[model samples]
Target: MGLFDNAVPGGNITKPLMIALGALLVGKMLSGKSAEQPQEAPAPAPTPAGTTSADGGLLGGLGGLLDKLRDAGHGNVADSWVGTGQNQSINPGDLGSALGPAVIREIAQRTGMNEQELLQQLSTALPGIVDKLTPNGQVPQQHQVASAFNS
Candidate 1:
């Protein structure tokens, strides 16, 4: 119904996780683009290299994450978040499995969070973040995503 329908439950820990994830995804989107391809959307100022990592094979940005979710049999859940519908909740364990070990490990390392806690926070935050990012029930252009992130 509302954005963040699955609101993150904890304080302090949650903000950094969202920031880390958002920064990583945005960095991937920017860096993955090439000189040959026409820039589809304007980009925000480049992020610091230290904040971005090629950790999860998230080379394709949110789409790559969606692909991983679909491959892990969470297509419906991913779709629900992308579509104009109620966001589907994911179990933390299921979320971990969908993201796989490399991603989880990388995220944990970056966030200074334990695997279990990272998964728990991500499971709650991701759907809402995806929902917010895809406000029109579709993946937005890169500039649009950057704007959303900026806001």
Candidate 2:
């Protein structure tokens, strides 16, 4: 095991799972508002940020974020979250490096949580959260990813 290697055995997570977990936590910041409830003003559906596949279509950003992590050499940890069997735990420090500064800053700004706090919360939630998302022991498709957030 090295810097970007999966810290736990049989652990698996993926881009979609991590991004969804982060987004889910951010959404949870809305003071007791359950994401499952219908809202007074329904949120806008996700749209592509640009003409790219990894831009912004609801979960598009998340998908892109996952790509970044994989590119950063944390794919194994991410995949473990999506893979079958036991999910792995992540080090908050490693997460910062895997996601890089820009993305971390963006998430921090959006969630209104400091970098360390956000990472800490994300680390705790990500493992179990992603496990739930990939119940079939496989990463979900783009549409399935988006639908989970919408509902």
Top candidate (TM-score)? 1
C-alpha RMSD by candidate, in order: 9.2, 9.0
* The best candidate in terms of lDDT: 1
lDDT of each: 0.63, 0.52
Clashing pairs in 2: 11-80, 12-79, 12-80, 12-81, 13-78, 13-79, 13-80, 13-81, 13-82, 14-78
Q: What's the TM-score of every candidate structure?
A: 0.69, 0.59
* TM-score of structure candidate 1: 0.69
Candidate 1 clashing pairs, residues 3+ apart or interchain: none
Q: How would you encode candidate 1's per-residue C-alpha lDDT over 83-130 as one tens digit per residue?
A: 998899999999888877766765565555788988887887777788
**Model 2, CA-based lDDT:** 0.52
Residue ranges of candidate 1 with Cα displaced over 4 Å: 1-13, 28-59
